[model samples]
Target: MRRLLAGLISLFCFTSSTYAAEVSVALAANFSAPMQKIAAAFEQDTGHKAVLSTGATGKFYAQIRHGAPFQLLLAADQTTPERLEREGLAVAGTRFTYAIGQLVLWSTEPGLVDAEGAVLRSERFTRIALADPKLAPYGAAALETLDKLGLRQQLQSKFVQGENIAQTYQFVASGNAPLGFVALSQVFADGRIREGSAWIVPAELHSPLLQDAVILKAGADNPAALALADYLRGEKARSIMQSYGYGF
Candidate 1:
């Protein structure tokens, strides 16, 4: 019994030291809810902590440019990561799209806006919230959908901007705004839309939301950073993401 106990102790110490590092991440707000799940699983499986910071993709770019100490970046769009790589801030050949996101016009109030977006034409609401188009990808999609339907100028006065997609969700969830555009992942449960009334914006309304992730140049030598990126592409992570309304 004593020998068995000693061996077990020896094994535990070896495993602990083997997976002791932490990986710092900059995650886009649209991905916050799912990333939380991924983070928990990642720590359990690898014993590497994931310290996450969530923000608008644009703002995160600014942070990286100014030396924010993030090891991995999961952006709502590919441009920022590509740009970072181009600017030599991220390691070359380490960039890839992690998930494809969808845009939705959502409201806590049922039937406020038809999923087809026909409600926007009626001008029934005094406020419509969205993230800043210059920041969040979902906001960009929202603006494009409105523009495609020629409601940009008509609804200009009612626009409320959030710093990121997460805040945009809060605007509607807290009734700060009656309706808003957000990532479909917000309302998705078990790979489907589970609650609230929403219009899954037609793809024709905007460009595809190809979210990307990459290892920053500052973390080029860190295996933990690469491992996190690899885990995102793994089956377990992909399953969790699918359950959250993201694709491939």
Candidate 2:
């Protein structure tokens, strides 16, 4: 009887361990910092691991369409996730807004970008970086802002495009471009600037960047993936996102 009972207990442990699965997430580059904190909290609270892949939302969309193994997608915009759902790549009714991103014109050099963003009119810099509008929503917002200011044509020769917001920020931070448009969350934390200079772009300059999250069809039945999605909507994850300058 003792031997039989011990074998049954071992089987139960094995089954329980198998159920504690790891979820793979494709995350937008701009949300990388805050997502790290959220992923860690998710693992601790749920006993499930979250593995992250970060890059431009466009690239992620392409990869998912081609059958990438990611179980979830945290997109930089709402459109991509909706497309995935419509195409049957994502689980239906699982999409929700996760964050609203803010765009900013930033420079690693202090005081280079004025609060009013008059520096663009000054045309003092040789090169300005922005993400490729075709690939990054923040880049689209930057382009819209430039167009609204009537500077797109004037500054056409000075534009440098990065494939994603992370690379766009790198171009300015590394001095390859004197100024660049980036996600505000990248340079701001805890209600203060973390470095250099920045001008928060007026919201009216572009459409609202509503970020969304969805469960891919591959993870529709995965407990870990479901848990991570729920955790993202919880107080802890929301607080971390707020600290990183993201709005719901």
RMSD of each: 1.8, 2.3
Which residues of candidate 2, in runs, are more than 4 Å off? 1-16
lDDT of the candidates, in the order given: 0.91, 0.94
Error of 1 at 44 (Å): 1.7
Candidate 1: tens digits of C-alpha lDDT, residues 132-216: 9999888989999998998999999999999999999999999999998999999878655666688889888899999999999
List TM-score per model, in order. 0.94, 0.94
Can you list the residue pairs that collide in candidate 2?
none
lDDT of 1: 0.91
